[model samples]
Target chain A: MKVPILKQGNILIATIQSALTDQDLISLKDNLSHQVIQHRSHGVVIDITELDVMDSFSTRTLRNIASILKLRGADTVIVGMQPDVAFAMVQLGLTLPNVKTARDLEEGLTLLK
Target chain B: MEKDTESEPTSSYAYNLMKEMKLDEEEILHRKAWLEFEEPDVNRLLELNDMAQGYATEVIESLYDHFLKFDDTKKFFEDPQVLNRVKNLQKKYFLRLTNGNYDDQYIQERIKIGSVHASIGLDVKWYLGAYGFYLRAVGKRIFKAFKSNPEKALESYFSLEKLVYMDIGLAIDTYIYQREATIKIQQEAIRELSTPVLQLREELLILPIIGAIDSQRARQLTEQLLHAIRDKRAKVVVIDITGVPTVDSRVANHLVQTVDASRLMGATLIITGLSAEVAQTLVTIGVDLAKINTVGDLQGGIEEAERILGYHVTKSLEDDSK
Candidate 1:
């Protein structure tokens, strides 16, 4: 299923609830880019708290989404990565460069604003 | 039959050990198996109580006399008063075998007995041998009491055997339980002692690590450091690992992971207090720690943290305030 990307005022909130396949994420990338432009959102908050088992591709895709939104004059902040996921991210030798993160959804909103 | 059922065990250690030993269920089940059926009867036990009440003193005297023959066993009784006191405890311990109530007090008393044997550092050989002697002594009495029919006599004798084995099982189990308890306490102490985050400066936190960094310990260390960073709002975190003995590649990665987590949590991390040995080991492993700041020792690390925090300790004001 396509993950829901909701727009609140000028900020876009995407809550990743599923372990998306490569195809699902590619669609997510295109869908988020189109939605951010259509809503003319100034900020996007990606909440991955419910999401687990993130590989390098998902991380890369998220980074790509951030960069694309940035080019569209939108800011992006990811929040709620579990501590073990943070450690695993480092173990895989890929630190998400230029990726802004917060501890939770509320913090993610605050960071975006 | 009911003594102090309304009150909890007064000693926390006793309460915990009793719970750990699962004495509640054992008392109900194990004691039932021994007290019921063909093993022993209440009337026979009451008779045994009267018969063996007189035997307590004589049996204890011989027991200690026999123990004094061995240098190893004799050393456990260093004083005459201690020997006498222990003999009294042992006398009670002996008669309780046939007293046969196997109530809560019986289980508690067995725990105390086992703990004493463990604390006094008595080997199991002496414990089992002492029981063997008591069995032989009690066996002779049984044979004499029922000499008319050997078959009837053996039943009473075998009942004592079953009861004694049950006691021995509780004793050994209590000994093992006490050891495991001691180890658990020591492990908690070690964890607390090893991972301490000390605030060295207003905006500086220092974590001095001195032991092996297993996955469990490393996770605890990381958690402690992260909270200290957030609570103290620390700008620079110094990890002093001079006391660390050796590092495998896995340990190196865990150390790196801790530094990375701190960075993610918005703190600048520094690695310091590396002895020559650890430095050489890191070099051999070809581990890359270039991304994070490093210092030779605590002094150097503090100086570096001060530099980052723009903290200048002028000799005049700093020394006078100190």
Candidate 2:
């Protein structure tokens, strides 16, 4: 999985590639938690358009990442979930706490800025 | 040693040879033929079939009569036309099962019937009780018919039990499938309809509010809008409420929370679509619009935004003056 990081001004954007499986989620939580603390970043956007599916484990990890970032005073936004995947996640009763979803990466990046 | 003419008929001899060569062949053919015609077992199944059909009819009639005694059940059956249709279909289903088809298609139909009953919110307990009574009545009838043949009577009872179990299982599966599908559709609709109220755009979060504001929808809108503002790191948010019919106190409170939430995330919230009547209603209701940026419409809000950002709307006018 490729984790693309871009920094423009005060906003830090991370575009996650591949499906957010359990292992990926753990790595993401660890990496993001470290980055938020290290940079004292106020805004973070995670683009997940490349991901096709998100199971319960992935959703929990995203929630964990958001909560940890919130503790560090950084706000997190999740973007690029396909409509079908979004519907399935909602059906499964999974939601990322304190994280907002956007239609695309551009919109997500624009919001972070 | 015997002459050809003195021997048994040539056809009879050939038949005997074929039978000896393929003894099981005749049984296989008989089974195949039975399947194609779906003939009831003359010796055992026929009597039980009639008994099952009669029992099903009696049970279904009694169940309906029982339902009519209760107000809730009676209310569901208020439409006489629908009730009659269901009753007629139930009769037909019993007849079909008793006809002894027992094919895959018949099994599927039986399952569908069970599922349909479940979907209509039929009292499962009542249905179970009624069905159990019917089954017992049928079993008694079969047992009486085979009073002299104990082994055959037991076999008949077991077969009937098996069929009932299979049909009930089919019904439950169908019911579960229908329920899950319905929930999935509703969830999707909620998500799709709520999308516009939580979108992030460049330099601003734009929430195009439409339709009547119910308390539930208002709360959902507020949460989504706030989450969008926080995640987008937006400095400004434009909420266009042109399609809103009227605002109540609860809706007003939700709007206040939305604005506060945006501010907490370091974003300014701009409220648009203040018609004369709405503005008057707000004042009458003692809902203060102070501390909230109220614009007459989207265009005015945009111009105000341009001014706040220190951008000249008419660069051509500046050039002409020079």
Candidate 3:
């Protein structure tokens, strides 16, 4: 399913709903990167509160998206990562090195500001 | 009663249980052989089915009467509806004894009943006592029914005893297994509670570590801190390890990993309460502490965290006004 990306001022907010297949995540990465350059957005917040399980591929994809956005001059702040997901991610040794994270969209925007 | 045409879904429990207990069909057959429960025993039990069904209700009522006399077992039947349901279930259980079809389905049913009893915190002693009461109640009825033929009555009683013992063995195993599983879950919860991540202020969190840091506890500590950092939108974190007893290479590595994970989440972590002994241990162990931001004490840690968040601690204006 397509993740709806909303634009607010100079920031792009992508709210993920339910489970996403690898292909959907790959498309989201492509779409987000493209939108970052087209909109000349200064920051992006990828909300994953609705996502229950985040496997290795999605973790790697998120990190990849952050790096790709960084190259385009847009800072990425992953937000709304559930506590259980964070625990599982840390246990699996998957971390988004050098990437910024926030508690929610409001915090993500404030960090970007 | 009309039999439901739909057959029960085949239970893999019998197979799973065999694997768990490290037993095969030959072992099971050997146990039955040891009990002297051959085809003749099965035939005898089936023959007693009609006569046993006649006394099943009376046996169940007397069993419950015995239960009601004791406060320990009586508490389970506080509600009349529950008592009725249980009494009906007991009747079925009693009748199934003589049904003489002890297969995987039978084992599965016994396990379910055992787990239920275990989950409800029923003491094993009470259940064992109930079994004794049940045996005597049924034995008396069987002996009276076959009074004209004493040899036939003894054979039927032996068959019945063997089946009851089999049921008892399976139920006890399930009870022990369920109890162990519950204990393991409780231990995990206690370990998680041992590491608490407290939010010190807006955009700041504090983790006060106490006790020893095993690999499991270290992992749990890191997980809890990372989650708190995200939940609190913490820009800075102060971890106070004043209560920690030791600092091995493993614990040091875990601390570093925690600092790194927090950094990934855009939170700066400050380690505090590093006593002279722990500092010496870290240096002696030669752990690379380049990423770890440490302070001398908890007060210093909180102060550093405030400074990171751009908070300047100033004296109250009332003091100057006075």
Candidate 4:
């Protein structure tokens, strides 16, 4: 998975590439939590355009990330989940901790700004 | 081949074949003594099996028919396809129970039934009640059939009852398992839906508003925003409304209350991204934003904040002026 960390003005954009598995979720939570604590970015945008499947375990991990980001005082948004994946998640009754979801990365970045 | 004889001693060749072969010895004996076995009139056992199956099917059908009489239960079967499928499965289950195969196949079938019921959100009470009716109907049928041969009838009834109990027990176990899993999923969803707003810095508190802001979400947002403002000791809270397309009265009240709550915690709430339509709608609805700090967009808000804090909005702006 490719995670690109960039700073545009006061916002921090983290573009997450590839499927977010349980391990990826853990690593993401750790890395993003550390970055949020370090930079104290006003806003954080997680671009998940490349993400495909999000199972129950991964959903829990995402929730953990949101919680950690919340403690560090950074807002988090999830972007670019395909509509079909979103629908499946909904059917599976999995939810990712109140994270904002955008249709595309551009909208997510724009929101962060 | 050896010549057939009316009185032939157990042959060594037959014994050797039986010992060497992997086939069941009992089945081989039965096949060899087919005439004697067939003469026992085991038709009674087959008849008893058929009777037990019929009893179970009649009971299940009557139970479902009774359930359909109730408006609530009737609604459960509103989907014709689901109703038909349930009926078909119930018939198949009765036949499997009577087939005397109480091994893994029977257990698995019962489990499948339980899972299907769980998927349709049928509670334990419904299953319990239905099973009670089934047992009662089966008992009544057995009693009616036992009018002639009491001993044989009693034996068959007991066997049927034992099998029914086993199958029903397995089904209930699967039902409970599925229910627990589904409940966990729902609980997880609720937790995910209620994420806390985080304050990243002393000066900047970001609140990402997403999804349809129902009353529940509105309340959560109010609490989260208030907590973030106080905990972070934030000076400015950017209430990003970019994810929010429009606002209802409850959502508008939530936003308004968030501003007031943040003010109480000594923070200025910067309401960002008043989309042209949202701005028009707010005005049309006569919602006064005079007390809230409104911003055209997030960048504009950040730049305005920098100007207020006596910092350059951009390095280019600083150089151009210098």
Q: How much TM-score does chain B earn in each model?
A: 0.78, 0.50, 0.65, 0.48
Candidate 3 Cα deviation (angstroms), residue B16: 21
DockQ of 3: 0.20
lDDT of 1: 0.76
Top candidate when judged by DockQ against the true structure: 1
Residue B119 in candidate 4, Cα distance off native in Å: 9.4
Q: List, in the given order, the native-contact fraction of each candidate.
A: 0.13, 0.00, 0.27, 0.00
Q: How close to the true structure is residue B15 of candidate 2, measured as C-alpha lDDT?
A: 42
lDDT of 2 at A52: 68
Kindly report which residue pairs in candidate 1 clash with one another. Answer: none
The DockQ of each candidate is 0.21, 0.09, 0.20, 0.03
Candidate that beats the other on TM-score, 1 or 3, i.e. the better one: 1
Best by lDDT: 3
C-alpha lDDT of residue A54 in model 1: 78
Error of 3 at A56 (Å): 3.3
Per-candidate count of clashing residue pairs (backbone under 3 Å)? 0, 1, 0, 2
Instruction: Give the per-residue lDDT of model 3 (tens digit) for B151-180.
Output: 888888888889878778777887788678
Clashing pairs in 2: A111-B232
lDDT of each: 0.76, 0.63, 0.81, 0.62
lDDT of 4 at B151: 72
TM-score of 4: 0.38
Candidate 3 error regions (>4 Å): B1-193, B226-235, B263-266, B280-288, B315-322
Q: How would the docking of model 1 be graded?
A: incorrect
